[model samples]
Target: MSMFDKTTKMAAVLKGHPKAKEVLESFGLQCSTCSGAKHESIELGATNHGLDVNELLTHLNALFDEPPGK
Candidate 1:
């Protein structure tokens, strides 16, 4: 999948994606289960929370882009 895939839902990211929750918490966002975030895209969340979208994107990518067991 492309790094900037807007179709990725935040809920799915948190549910099955490993780095999502850690990144969110590092940014002081602890409510991954909140209804507003359940259906929103990562970009939407970054915008709403005043976070840098590019930084979030980098973190998300690092989680997925690394070699297995690296």
Candidate 2:
């Protein structure tokens, strides 16, 4: 299972994650400047922006994947 799933909140993902913000931008999610953007879930944001939730999760998880030997 991925650490950050589709139901994960956008703010939580972006928090302390500059790379996440960049990835979201690359995915064409421009909600950072909008009201309640931080409160939106990943699925909600992706759906509202006409993006594929699974694909977005794939990209996001890649950016935040945990390393082995932890």
Candidate 3:
């Protein structure tokens, strides 16, 4: 039961998780300011950025375990 996967849209991820921007930035993805974030899926972004999609998803899903303001 992961909170996000390859098909998850960047916009949806940002909206769904409070720390998504931070997490994304850590992986070198400046999604918050990118227009493509509106329609780009995690998989696409990762591929375009030369990142490992599975690694990104792992970090993104880890956010689900944190307390709401952490």
Best by TM-score: 3
Please provide, for model 3 over 1-70, each residue's C-alpha lDDT reduced to its tens digit, 9 standing for 90 to 100.
4789899999999998889899999998999999999899999999999999999999999999887777
Question: Per-residue error at 6 for model 1, in Å?
Answer: 3.7
| Better by TM-score, candidate 2 or 1 | 2
Local distance difference test, candidate 2: 0.79
Candidate 3 at 29: error in angstroms?
A: 0.8
TM-score, per-candidate, Cα-based: 0.73, 0.78, 0.93
- Give the better candidate number (2 or 3) by lDDT: 3
In model 3, the clashing pairs are none
Predictions in order: lDDT: 0.72, 0.79, 0.93
Model 1 ranges off by over 4 Å: 1-4, 67-70
| Candidates ranked by lDDT | 3, 2, 1
Worst 10 residues of 3 by lDDT: 61-70
Cα lDDT tens digits, model 1, 1-70, are 4454555677876875666688778987664767876778878887888998778777776677767665
- Rank the models by TM-score, top first: 3, 2, 1
Residue pairs with backbone overlap in model 1: none
Poorly placed runs, candidate 2 (over 4 Å): 66-70
Better of 1 and 2 by lDDT: 2
